[model samples]
Target: MTRKPPPDTTPDGHHVVIGGRRWRATDPAIPDDVGARLRVHLMAARRAVGVALRAHDPEAERAARDRVQSAKVALGERGTPWWEQSPEERRTRWQDGLAALDAQGAQGAQDA
Candidate 1:
Protein backbone atom coordinates (compact mmCIF):
# COMPACT_ATOMS: atom_id res chain seq x y z
CA MET A 1 0.00 0.00 0.00
CA THR A 2 1.10 3.58 -0.68
CA ARG A 3 1.71 6.13 2.06
CA LYS A 4 -1.20 8.35 2.93
CA PRO A 5 -0.79 12.00 2.07
CA PRO A 6 0.20 14.20 4.99
CA PRO A 7 -2.24 16.88 5.92
CA ASP A 8 0.61 19.30 6.51
CA THR A 9 1.76 21.49 3.67
CA THR A 10 5.20 21.25 2.07
CA PRO A 11 7.95 23.84 2.58
CA ASP A 12 6.66 25.77 -0.44
CA GLY A 13 3.08 25.53 0.78
CA HIS A 14 2.31 22.47 -1.31
CA HIS A 15 1.62 18.82 -0.67
CA VAL A 16 4.67 16.57 -0.63
CA VAL A 17 5.10 15.14 -4.09
CA ILE A 18 6.09 11.56 -4.73
CA GLY A 19 5.30 9.11 -7.49
CA GLY A 20 3.14 11.83 -9.11
CA ARG A 21 1.15 12.54 -5.96
CA ARG A 22 1.39 13.75 -2.41
CA TRP A 23 3.11 11.40 0.01
CA ARG A 24 4.02 11.11 3.70
CA ALA A 25 6.35 9.09 5.89
CA THR A 26 3.53 7.46 7.77
CA ASP A 27 3.12 3.80 6.80
CA PRO A 28 6.06 3.99 4.42
CA ALA A 29 5.51 1.14 1.97
CA ILE A 30 9.23 0.91 1.35
CA PRO A 31 12.34 1.20 3.51
CA ASP A 32 15.58 2.90 2.49
CA ASP A 33 17.77 0.24 4.08
CA VAL A 34 15.93 -2.55 2.33
CA GLY A 35 16.58 -1.03 -1.06
CA ALA A 36 20.21 -0.39 -0.20
CA ARG A 37 20.85 -3.97 0.86
CA LEU A 38 19.11 -5.35 -2.17
CA ARG A 39 21.44 -3.36 -4.38
CA VAL A 40 24.40 -4.67 -2.40
CA HIS A 41 23.27 -8.29 -2.79
CA LEU A 42 22.68 -7.77 -6.47
CA MET A 43 26.16 -6.34 -6.83
CA ALA A 44 27.69 -9.23 -4.95
CA ALA A 45 25.85 -11.72 -7.12
CA ARG A 46 27.13 -9.99 -10.24
CA ARG A 47 30.65 -10.09 -8.90
CA ALA A 48 30.34 -13.81 -8.21
CA VAL A 49 29.38 -14.44 -11.79
CA GLY A 50 32.29 -12.38 -13.02
CA VAL A 51 34.66 -14.40 -10.91
CA ALA A 52 33.17 -17.58 -12.33
CA LEU A 53 33.76 -16.32 -15.86
CA ARG A 54 37.48 -16.14 -15.16
CA ALA A 55 37.53 -19.91 -14.92
CA HIS A 56 39.44 -21.72 -17.66
CA ASP A 57 36.46 -23.65 -18.98
CA PRO A 58 34.42 -21.37 -21.24
CA GLU A 59 31.30 -23.54 -21.23
CA ALA A 60 31.17 -23.86 -17.44
CA GLU A 61 31.80 -20.15 -17.01
CA ARG A 62 28.99 -19.34 -19.45
CA ALA A 63 26.57 -21.50 -17.49
CA ALA A 64 27.42 -19.69 -14.27
CA ARG A 65 27.00 -16.32 -15.95
CA ASP A 66 23.60 -17.35 -17.29
CA ARG A 67 22.49 -18.41 -13.83
CA VAL A 68 23.48 -15.03 -12.43
CA GLN A 69 21.54 -13.19 -15.10
CA SER A 70 18.44 -15.27 -14.43
CA ALA A 71 18.74 -14.72 -10.69
CA LYS A 72 19.06 -10.97 -11.17
CA VAL A 73 15.92 -10.82 -13.31
CA ALA A 74 14.00 -12.81 -10.71
CA LEU A 75 15.15 -10.51 -7.93
CA GLY A 76 14.18 -7.41 -9.84
CA GLU A 77 10.65 -8.68 -10.52
CA ARG A 78 9.99 -9.69 -6.90
CA GLY A 79 8.68 -6.10 -6.33
CA THR A 80 9.21 -6.05 -2.54
CA PRO A 81 13.00 -6.09 -3.21
CA TRP A 82 15.59 -8.78 -2.58
CA TRP A 83 16.68 -7.72 0.90
CA GLU A 84 13.06 -7.51 1.99
CA GLN A 85 12.42 -11.09 0.93
CA SER A 86 12.01 -13.53 3.83
CA PRO A 87 15.21 -15.13 5.14
CA GLU A 88 14.19 -18.51 3.81
CA GLU A 89 13.86 -17.27 0.26
CA ARG A 90 17.19 -15.49 0.37
CA ARG A 91 18.99 -18.48 1.87
CA THR A 92 17.47 -20.84 -0.63
CA ARG A 93 18.63 -18.76 -3.56
CA TRP A 94 22.11 -18.40 -2.13
CA GLN A 95 22.40 -22.11 -1.50
CA ASP A 96 21.13 -23.01 -4.93
CA GLY A 97 23.60 -20.74 -6.66
CA LEU A 98 26.45 -21.95 -4.52
CA ALA A 99 25.54 -25.53 -5.32
CA ALA A 100 25.59 -24.81 -9.01
CA LEU A 101 28.96 -23.15 -8.73
CA ASP A 102 30.31 -26.04 -6.71
CA ALA A 103 29.17 -28.48 -9.33
CA GLN A 104 30.86 -26.51 -12.03
CA GLY A 105 34.06 -26.31 -10.03
CA ALA A 106 33.96 -30.06 -9.38
CA GLN A 107 33.62 -30.73 -13.08
CA GLY A 108 36.56 -28.50 -13.78
CA ALA A 109 38.55 -30.38 -11.18
CA GLN A 110 37.73 -33.71 -12.81
CA ASP A 111 38.79 -32.36 -16.19
CA ALA A 112 42.08 -31.14 -14.73
Candidate 2:
Protein backbone atom coordinates (compact mmCIF):
# COMPACT_ATOMS: atom_id res chain seq x y z
CA MET A 1 0.00 0.00 0.00
CA THR A 2 1.21 3.45 -0.86
CA ARG A 3 1.19 6.05 1.89
CA LYS A 4 -0.23 9.45 1.09
CA PRO A 5 2.12 12.40 1.17
CA PRO A 6 1.78 14.99 3.90
CA PRO A 7 -0.60 17.85 3.15
CA ASP A 8 0.71 21.13 1.86
CA THR A 9 0.74 24.02 4.29
CA THR A 10 -0.07 27.62 3.54
CA PRO A 11 2.91 29.97 3.30
CA ASP A 12 2.25 31.19 6.83
CA GLY A 13 1.95 27.55 8.03
CA HIS A 14 -1.22 28.08 10.02
CA HIS A 15 -3.31 25.85 7.79
CA VAL A 16 -2.87 22.81 5.58
CA VAL A 17 -4.27 22.43 2.05
CA ILE A 18 -5.79 19.11 1.06
CA GLY A 19 -7.95 18.58 -1.99
CA GLY A 20 -8.07 22.36 -2.52
CA ARG A 21 -9.51 22.82 0.97
CA ARG A 22 -7.92 24.54 3.95
CA TRP A 23 -7.87 23.15 7.47
CA ARG A 24 -6.28 24.47 10.63
CA ALA A 25 -2.93 22.87 11.39
CA THR A 26 -1.92 21.43 14.69
CA ASP A 27 0.16 23.75 16.87
CA PRO A 28 3.86 23.42 16.16
CA ALA A 29 4.71 24.25 19.74
CA ILE A 30 3.11 21.11 21.09
CA PRO A 31 5.67 18.64 22.42
CA ASP A 32 5.97 15.34 20.55
CA ASP A 33 4.79 13.14 23.43
CA VAL A 34 1.72 15.27 24.13
CA GLY A 35 0.82 15.45 20.47
CA ALA A 36 1.05 11.67 20.12
CA ARG A 37 -1.26 11.11 23.10
CA LEU A 38 -3.79 13.58 21.72
CA ARG A 39 -3.76 11.82 18.35
CA VAL A 40 -4.39 8.50 20.07
CA HIS A 41 -7.40 9.94 21.85
CA LEU A 42 -8.65 11.53 18.65
CA MET A 43 -8.45 8.26 16.72
CA ALA A 44 -10.09 6.28 19.49
CA ALA A 45 -12.90 8.80 19.76
CA ARG A 46 -13.40 8.62 16.02
CA ARG A 47 -13.63 4.84 16.16
CA ALA A 48 -16.05 5.07 19.05
CA VAL A 49 -18.22 7.38 17.00
CA GLY A 50 -18.38 4.79 14.24
CA VAL A 51 -19.22 2.01 16.66
CA ALA A 52 -21.97 4.09 18.24
CA LEU A 53 -23.43 4.88 14.84
CA ARG A 54 -23.49 1.22 13.92
CA ALA A 55 -25.28 0.43 17.16
CA HIS A 56 -27.80 3.25 16.66
CA ASP A 57 -26.78 4.77 19.96
CA PRO A 58 -27.23 8.51 19.72
CA GLU A 59 -26.01 9.21 23.24
CA ALA A 60 -22.78 7.29 22.73
CA GLU A 61 -22.18 8.96 19.40
CA ARG A 62 -22.62 12.39 20.92
CA ALA A 63 -20.19 11.56 23.69
CA ALA A 64 -17.62 10.23 21.25
CA ARG A 65 -17.93 13.32 19.07
CA ASP A 66 -17.43 15.51 22.11
CA ARG A 67 -14.18 13.66 22.79
CA VAL A 68 -13.09 14.27 19.22
CA GLN A 69 -13.75 17.99 19.60
CA SER A 70 -11.82 18.14 22.84
CA ALA A 71 -8.82 16.41 21.32
CA LYS A 72 -8.86 18.70 18.31
CA VAL A 73 -9.13 21.82 20.40
CA ALA A 74 -6.31 20.65 22.61
CA LEU A 75 -4.14 19.94 19.57
CA GLY A 76 -4.81 23.53 18.42
CA GLU A 77 -6.64 22.29 15.33
CA ARG A 78 -9.88 23.86 16.57
CA GLY A 79 -11.07 26.60 18.97
CA THR A 80 -8.89 29.74 19.09
CA PRO A 81 -6.31 29.82 16.34
CA TRP A 82 -2.95 28.66 17.72
CA TRP A 83 -1.01 31.53 16.17
CA GLU A 84 -3.25 34.03 17.94
CA GLN A 85 -2.59 32.51 21.35
CA SER A 86 0.29 33.43 23.64
CA PRO A 87 2.94 30.88 24.52
CA GLU A 88 1.50 30.30 27.98
CA GLU A 89 -1.98 29.87 26.59
CA ARG A 90 -0.78 27.34 24.05
CA ARG A 91 0.94 25.30 26.73
CA THR A 92 -2.05 25.38 29.00
CA ARG A 93 -4.40 24.36 26.24
CA TRP A 94 -2.50 21.17 25.43
CA GLN A 95 -1.70 20.33 29.02
CA ASP A 96 -5.29 20.67 30.13
CA GLY A 97 -6.51 18.79 27.10
CA LEU A 98 -4.19 15.87 27.78
CA ALA A 99 -5.31 15.72 31.38
CA ALA A 100 -8.95 15.67 30.40
CA LEU A 101 -8.46 13.03 27.71
CA ASP A 102 -6.48 10.88 30.14
CA ALA A 103 -9.24 11.11 32.70
CA GLN A 104 -11.83 10.13 30.14
CA GLY A 105 -9.81 7.09 29.16
CA ALA A 106 -9.48 6.01 32.76
CA GLN A 107 -13.18 6.44 33.31
CA GLY A 108 -14.02 4.39 30.25
CA ALA A 109 -11.69 1.62 31.35
CA GLN A 110 -13.32 1.48 34.75
CA ASP A 111 -16.79 1.36 33.25
CA ALA A 112 -15.82 -1.43 30.93
Candidate 3:
Protein backbone atom coordinates (compact mmCIF):
# COMPACT_ATOMS: atom_id res chain seq x y z
CA MET A 1 0.00 0.00 0.00
CA THR A 2 1.23 3.49 -0.82
CA ARG A 3 1.75 5.53 2.32
CA LYS A 4 1.79 9.27 2.76
CA PRO A 5 5.11 10.70 3.84
CA PRO A 6 5.39 13.21 6.65
CA PRO A 7 4.50 16.76 5.64
CA ASP A 8 8.14 17.70 6.09
CA THR A 9 9.15 15.48 3.16
CA THR A 10 7.72 14.36 -0.13
CA PRO A 11 6.79 10.78 -0.91
CA ASP A 12 10.06 10.49 -2.80
CA GLY A 13 12.00 11.78 0.24
CA HIS A 14 12.61 15.38 -0.92
CA HIS A 15 12.69 17.82 2.00
CA VAL A 16 9.58 19.97 1.93
CA VAL A 17 7.40 21.83 4.36
CA ILE A 18 3.78 22.88 4.27
CA GLY A 19 3.13 26.57 4.41
CA GLY A 20 -0.47 27.71 4.02
CA ARG A 21 -1.17 24.15 2.97
CA ARG A 22 1.22 24.44 0.03
CA TRP A 23 4.41 22.43 -0.18
CA ARG A 24 7.65 24.37 -0.32
CA ALA A 25 11.19 23.12 -0.79
CA THR A 26 13.11 23.60 2.46
CA ASP A 27 16.44 24.13 0.73
CA PRO A 28 17.52 27.02 -1.49
CA ALA A 29 15.65 29.74 0.31
CA ILE A 30 14.77 32.86 -1.68
CA PRO A 31 16.11 36.14 -0.38
CA ASP A 32 13.62 38.88 0.56
CA ASP A 33 15.02 41.39 -1.95
CA VAL A 34 14.92 38.81 -4.72
CA GLY A 35 11.35 37.86 -3.91
CA ALA A 36 10.26 41.49 -3.84
CA ARG A 37 11.93 42.22 -7.16
CA LEU A 38 10.35 39.09 -8.60
CA ARG A 39 6.94 40.37 -7.59
CA VAL A 40 7.55 43.65 -9.36
CA HIS A 41 8.70 41.90 -12.50
CA LEU A 42 5.67 39.61 -12.41
CA MET A 43 3.30 42.57 -12.36
CA ALA A 44 4.96 44.23 -15.35
CA ALA A 45 5.02 40.99 -17.28
CA ARG A 46 1.30 40.56 -16.77
CA ARG A 47 0.64 43.93 -18.33
CA ALA A 48 2.87 43.35 -21.34
CA VAL A 49 1.24 40.00 -22.04
CA GLY A 50 -2.16 41.64 -22.03
CA VAL A 51 -0.89 44.12 -24.59
CA ALA A 52 0.45 41.45 -26.92
CA LEU A 53 -2.73 39.37 -26.74
CA ARG A 54 -4.74 42.47 -27.60
CA ALA A 55 -3.26 42.40 -31.09
CA HIS A 56 -4.77 39.03 -32.02
CA ASP A 57 -8.05 39.53 -30.21
CA PRO A 58 -9.25 42.99 -31.15
CA GLU A 59 -12.41 42.49 -29.13
CA ALA A 60 -10.32 42.10 -25.97
CA GLU A 61 -9.16 45.71 -26.01
CA ARG A 62 -11.34 46.64 -23.08
CA ALA A 63 -10.32 43.69 -20.92
CA ALA A 64 -6.75 44.28 -21.86
CA ARG A 65 -7.13 47.72 -20.40
CA ASP A 66 -8.54 46.21 -17.24
CA ARG A 67 -5.70 43.69 -16.90
CA VAL A 68 -3.12 46.35 -17.50
CA GLN A 69 -4.80 48.33 -14.79
CA SER A 70 -4.72 45.43 -12.32
CA ALA A 71 -1.06 44.80 -12.98
CA LYS A 72 -0.47 48.47 -12.56
CA VAL A 73 -2.20 48.36 -9.20
CA ALA A 74 0.16 45.63 -8.14
CA LEU A 75 3.33 46.97 -9.72
CA GLY A 76 2.41 50.61 -10.37
CA GLU A 77 2.74 52.58 -13.65
CA ARG A 78 6.55 52.84 -13.40
CA GLY A 79 7.38 49.56 -11.72
CA THR A 80 9.76 46.88 -12.96
CA PRO A 81 10.35 46.45 -16.69
CA TRP A 82 8.12 43.95 -18.48
CA TRP A 83 11.15 42.33 -20.13
CA GLU A 84 12.37 41.31 -16.67
CA GLN A 85 9.12 39.60 -15.72
CA SER A 86 8.94 35.83 -15.60
CA PRO A 87 7.73 33.93 -18.68
CA GLU A 88 5.15 31.86 -16.82
CA GLU A 89 3.35 34.93 -15.48
CA ARG A 90 3.31 36.48 -18.94
CA ARG A 91 1.88 33.35 -20.61
CA THR A 92 -0.93 32.96 -18.08
CA ARG A 93 -2.01 36.57 -18.34
CA TRP A 94 -1.85 36.37 -22.14
CA GLN A 95 -4.11 33.33 -22.34
CA ASP A 96 -6.81 34.91 -20.20
CA GLY A 97 -6.50 38.32 -21.85
CA LEU A 98 -6.60 36.98 -25.42
CA ALA A 99 -9.73 34.95 -24.68
CA ALA A 100 -11.45 37.98 -23.20
CA LEU A 101 -10.62 40.06 -26.30
CA ASP A 102 -11.83 37.38 -28.67
CA ALA A 103 -15.16 37.24 -26.87
CA GLN A 104 -15.56 40.99 -26.90
CA GLY A 105 -14.87 41.20 -30.63
CA ALA A 106 -17.31 38.42 -31.42
CA GLN A 107 -19.99 40.09 -29.33
CA GLY A 108 -19.42 43.41 -31.04
CA ALA A 109 -19.57 41.83 -34.48
CA GLN A 110 -22.80 40.12 -33.59
CA ASP A 111 -24.31 43.37 -32.41
CA ALA A 112 -23.46 45.14 -35.64
Candidate 4:
Protein backbone atom coordinates (compact mmCIF):
# COMPACT_ATOMS: atom_id res chain seq x y z
CA MET A 1 0.00 0.00 0.00
CA THR A 2 1.16 3.49 -0.81
CA ARG A 3 1.66 5.79 2.17
CA LYS A 4 0.15 9.23 2.15
CA PRO A 5 2.46 12.20 2.31
CA PRO A 6 2.71 14.24 5.47
CA PRO A 7 0.20 17.04 5.95
CA ASP A 8 1.09 20.56 4.90
CA THR A 9 1.85 22.89 7.78
CA THR A 10 1.40 26.64 7.89
CA PRO A 11 4.43 28.77 7.12
CA ASP A 12 5.04 29.19 10.83
CA GLY A 13 4.79 25.42 11.31
CA HIS A 14 2.23 25.75 14.09
CA HIS A 15 -0.70 24.01 12.42
CA VAL A 16 -1.35 21.51 9.67
CA VAL A 17 -3.96 21.87 6.98
CA ILE A 18 -5.75 18.69 5.97
CA GLY A 19 -8.71 18.57 3.59
CA GLY A 20 -8.97 22.37 4.00
CA ARG A 21 -9.17 22.18 7.77
CA ARG A 22 -6.51 23.44 10.14
CA TRP A 23 -5.39 21.65 13.29
CA ARG A 24 -2.62 22.25 15.80
CA ALA A 25 0.55 20.38 14.96
CA THR A 26 2.45 18.14 17.32
CA ASP A 27 5.49 19.73 18.95
CA PRO A 28 8.50 19.35 16.69
CA ALA A 29 10.73 19.13 19.72
CA ILE A 30 9.32 15.72 20.64
CA PRO A 31 11.83 12.96 20.11
CA ASP A 32 10.75 10.50 17.42
CA ASP A 33 10.67 7.56 19.84
CA VAL A 34 8.61 9.50 22.36
CA GLY A 35 6.27 10.80 19.69
CA ALA A 36 5.74 7.29 18.32
CA ARG A 37 4.87 5.96 21.75
CA LEU A 38 2.42 8.77 22.34
CA ARG A 39 0.78 8.12 18.99
CA VAL A 40 0.39 4.47 19.90
CA HIS A 41 -1.43 5.46 23.07
CA LEU A 42 -3.59 7.94 21.19
CA MET A 43 -4.64 5.37 18.62
CA ALA A 44 -5.36 2.76 21.23
CA ALA A 45 -7.46 5.18 23.17
CA ARG A 46 -9.38 6.06 20.04
CA ARG A 47 -10.08 2.40 19.35
CA ALA A 48 -11.25 1.94 22.91
CA VAL A 49 -13.64 4.82 22.46
CA GLY A 50 -15.11 3.10 19.42
CA VAL A 51 -15.38 -0.21 21.25
CA ALA A 52 -17.17 1.42 24.17
CA LEU A 53 -19.54 3.20 21.85
CA ARG A 54 -20.42 -0.05 20.10
CA ALA A 55 -21.11 -1.69 23.43
CA HIS A 56 -23.30 1.26 24.51
CA ASP A 57 -21.19 1.65 27.58
CA PRO A 58 -21.28 5.31 28.59
CA GLU A 59 -18.79 5.04 31.43
CA ALA A 60 -16.25 3.19 29.31
CA GLU A 61 -16.67 5.70 26.52
CA ARG A 62 -16.06 8.59 28.87
CA ALA A 63 -12.94 6.97 30.26
CA ALA A 64 -11.61 6.18 26.79
CA ARG A 65 -12.30 9.72 25.64
CA ASP A 66 -10.46 11.05 28.63
CA ARG A 67 -7.48 9.01 27.57
CA VAL A 68 -7.75 10.48 24.09
CA GLN A 69 -7.66 13.98 25.53
CA SER A 70 -4.67 13.14 27.65
CA ALA A 71 -2.76 11.78 24.66
CA LYS A 72 -3.62 14.82 22.58
CA VAL A 73 -2.49 17.19 25.33
CA ALA A 74 0.72 15.26 25.69
CA LEU A 75 1.37 15.48 21.97
CA GLY A 76 0.97 19.26 22.21
CA GLU A 77 -2.10 19.10 20.00
CA ARG A 78 -4.36 20.26 22.83
CA GLY A 79 -4.29 22.30 26.05
CA THR A 80 -1.63 25.06 26.00
CA PRO A 81 -0.32 25.50 22.49
CA TRP A 82 3.19 24.16 22.27
CA TRP A 83 4.34 27.30 20.46
CA GLU A 84 3.44 29.40 23.48
CA GLN A 85 5.49 27.28 25.84
CA SER A 86 9.17 27.53 26.64
CA PRO A 87 11.40 24.63 25.62
CA GLU A 88 11.51 23.40 29.20
CA GLU A 89 7.73 23.59 29.52
CA ARG A 90 7.20 21.73 26.26
CA ARG A 91 9.58 19.01 27.34
CA THR A 92 7.81 18.69 30.64
CA ARG A 93 4.43 18.50 28.95
CA TRP A 94 5.29 15.48 26.80
CA GLN A 95 7.27 13.75 29.55
CA ASP A 96 4.49 14.13 32.07
CA GLY A 97 1.97 12.92 29.50
CA LEU A 98 4.03 9.85 28.75
CA ALA A 99 4.30 9.01 32.42
CA ALA A 100 0.59 9.41 32.97
CA LEU A 101 -0.31 7.34 29.93
CA ASP A 102 2.05 4.61 31.06
CA ALA A 103 0.49 4.56 34.47
CA GLN A 104 -2.97 4.32 32.97
CA GLY A 105 -1.89 1.40 30.82
CA ALA A 106 -0.55 -0.37 33.89
CA GLN A 107 -3.77 0.25 35.75
CA GLY A 108 -5.78 -1.05 32.81
CA ALA A 109 -3.77 -4.27 32.66
CA GLN A 110 -4.38 -4.84 36.34
CA ASP A 111 -8.08 -4.25 35.85
CA ALA A 112 -8.17 -6.88 33.16
Q: Pick the candidate with the highest TM-score.
A: 4
Which residue pairs come into collision in candidate 1?
A: none
Predicted candidate 2 versus true structure: per-residue lDDT over 1-112, tens digit per residue = 9999999999999999999999999999999999999999999999999999999999999999999999999999999999999999999999999999999999999999
Q: Which ten residues in a row have the lowest lDDT in candidate 2?
A: 4-13
Model 3 vs truth, CA RMSD: 14.7
Residue lDDT tens for model 3, 1-112: 9997756655543335666354433112233553354345445446646765757765555554555554333332224333344756544444443455445446646975
Q: Which lDDT tens digits does candidate 1 get at residues 1-112?
A: 8997655545644234665665422112223554344445456556756776676666656665565554443333332344455766655554554455446556756976
Q: TM-score for every candidate vs. truth?
A: 0.34, 0.96, 0.29, 0.98
Kindly provide the TM-score of model 2 when superposed on the true structure, using C-alpha atoms.
Answer: 0.96
Model 4, span 1-112: residue lDDT tens: 9999999999999999999999999999999999999999999999999999999999999999999999999999999999999999999999999999999999999999
The predicted structure with the larger TM-score, 2 or 3, is: 2
User: Of the pair 1 and 2, which is ahead by TM-score?
Assistant: 2
Task: Predict model 1's lDDT versus the native.
Answer: 0.49
Best by lDDT: 2
Better of 1 and 4 by lDDT: 4
Error of 1 at 111 (Å): 2.1
The list of candidate 3 runs beyond 4 A from truth reads: 1-80
lDDT-based ranking: 2, 4, 1, 3
**Candidate 4 Cα lDDT to native:** 0.98
TM-score ranking, high to low = 4, 2, 1, 3
List the global CA lDDT of all models: 0.49, 0.99, 0.46, 0.98
